[model samples]
Target: MRAVRFEGVGRIAVQELEKPAPGSGDLVVRVEASGICGTDRHILRGEFSSRPPVTLGHEFSGIVEAIGPGVTRFKVGHRVTGDPNIACGLCPSCRAGHVNLCESLEAIGVTRDGGLAEYVLVPEKQALSLPADLPPLYGAFCEPLACSIHGVDIAGLRPGMSAIVLGGGVIGMLVVQLARLAGATRTVMITRQAAKRQLAEQLGATASADPSAGDAVFDICGPGGLLSGGADVVFECAGVPDTVALAPKLARRGGAAVILGVLRPQDRVEIAPLELLLREVRLLTSFLNPFTHARAADLIATGAIDVAPLVTRQIGLEEAPGVISEPPPAGEIRAIVVP
Candidate 1:
C-alpha cells in the first residue's frame, strides 16, 4: 500500500507500507478519496500538534473492505465516511456529552494511521454509513461538513438572522450554505479572492466582499452598507489572526461571533474586550465535530449540500506529498487524493 506519511516538521512523503487489517471492533476501509486540509499543512509545518511518522489524512471516505470481530454496525462492501476524532468515553467532557472536548482525545491521521493510503483501520463507532450510489469523492466532504455543522450549532443561528462568514475556503464555503439552510436571510462572505467571492454568492451567500479592500469594514457595516448594523452572527473561518480580530467587529450589538478556524498554538490575536462587553457580544469558539457526522453523511447522500463544486482538483497518492507541501493554488477550494 502507498501512504502519505508526515515524518516530522517540514517533512512529508509517500512511502510504501503494509495494508492494515481490522482490529477488534474495527473496520478496514479501502480508501476511495481523501481531501487535503489546511490542518495538513499546519501539521507538516509543526504549527499544529500531531504525531509524526503517521499517515496524514483526516478527511476521508471509503468502502468497507473487511470487518473485525464485535463490529455489528458495518459490513464488508458498505460505503462509509470516517469521523476521525476519537474521544475517551470516561473523560469529564465525554461524560458531560461534550465529547469533542475529551481530555484524552486522539485523532486518526493526527495520532494514528489514517486514510491517505490503500487501507486504513477505522473503529466501528467512528464510521458513518454513506449511500452506496452516492459519488465516492463527495463522501470525503462529510468530515468537514460535520465540523461546520458543529460551528453552526454553536452560533445558534435563527430564521431571518444575518451571518457573515470570513474566509472563502472549504470551511467558509460550507458555512455559507449551512447558514442559508439555517434560515439566515442575509449571508455575506468576506475574502480576498475574487473567484471565491463569486463562488460564495453562487452557493447562497446573499452578497460577497473582498477584505483586501481597505474599506471592507465600513462598506459592509457602515451607514448605508450592505449590512448597515453588522451581522447577527459572524464566523471566523480563515484561521488567521486578522480574521479572528475582525469577527467580533462585524457582529451586531448583542450578537455573537464564532471562531471555527484552527490557528497555530502560539498564534496570538488582538481583540477589544471592552467593546464586546459593552455590546454584550458573545465570543465563542467551536472545536471538533462532536455529534454531527451522521447529519453530514445524510446531507451528502441526499444531495442537500452541494459538494461537487467544492472539489477544486484531484490527485493521486503520489502527488499528495507535493500538494500538501505547498500552499493551495489560487482559486483552489479543496484537492482530493484518489488513492
Candidate 2:
C-alpha cells in the first residue's frame, strides 16, 4: 500500500507501506476516494496542529475490505464514510454532549493513519454507512459536508431569513446549499474568484459579490444593498483574517455571525467591540462535526445536496503529494484523490 505521509513541516511524500489490518472493533477500508482539504495545506505549512509521520487525509470514503471482531453494525462489503474525529467518551465535553470540544480529541489523518493510502483502518464508532450505490467520489464529501452542517446548525437560520456566506470554496458552496435548505430565502456569496461566484449562484445563492471589486461589507450590507440592512446570518468560511473580521459586520442587528473557517494557529483578527455591542450581534464559532456525520451522509446519499459541482478535479494517490504540497489551483473548489 502507498500512503501520503507528512514527514514534517514542509515535507510530504507518497511512500509504500504495509497495508493495515482491522484491529478489534475496527474496519479495514480500501480507499476509494479522498478529498484534499485546505487543512492539508495548513498542516504542510505547519500552520495547523497535526502529528507528523502520519497519513494526511481526513475527508474520505471507501468500501469495507475486512472487519474486525465485535464489528457487527457494518459488514465487509459496506460502503462507508469515516468521521475522522474521535472523542474520548469519558471527557467532560463528551459527557455534556459537546463531543467536538472533547478535552483530548484525536482525529484520523491528523493523529493516526488515514485514508490517503490504498487502505486505512477505521474504528467502528467512526464509520458511518453510506448507500452502496452512492458514487465513490461523492462519498468523499461527507466529511466536509458534515462540518458545514454543524456551521448551519449554529447559525439557526429560519424561513425567509437572509444569509451571507464568505468565500466560495467547497465549504462556502456547501454552506450556501445548507442555508437554503435551512430556510434562508436570500443567500449571498462573496468571493474573489468569478468562477466560484457563478457556481454559487447556480447552487442556490440568491446573489454573489466580488470581494476584490471594492468594499464587500458595504456592497452587500450597506443600506439598499443586497440584503439591505444586512443578513440574518453570516457564515465566515474563507478561514482568513479579512473574512473573519468582516463576518460579524455583515449580520443584521441582533443576527448571528458564525465562524466556520479554520485559521492558522497563530493567526489573529481585530473586531470592533463598540460596533458589536451597539448592534447586539451574536458572534459565535462552530468547530468540527460533533454529531452531524450521519445526517450529512443521508443528504449526500439522497441527492439533497449537489456535490458534483464542488469536485473540481481528480488525481491519483501518486499525484496527491504534489497537490498537497502546492497551493490550490485558481478557482479549484476541491481535488479528489482516487486511490
Clash count list over all predictions: 0, 0
lDDT of 2 by residue, 197-230 (tens): 9999999999999888877657678877879889
Error of 2 at 225 (Å): 2.1
Model 1: per-residue Cα lDDT at residue 206:
94
Global lDDT scores for all candidate models: 0.94, 0.93
Which stretches in model 1 have alpha-carbon errors above 4 Å?
Answer: none
Worst ten in a row by lDDT for model 1 = 210-219
Per-residue CA lDDT of candidate 1, range 289-338, in tens? 99999999998899889999999999999999999999998999999999
TM-score of each: 0.98, 0.98
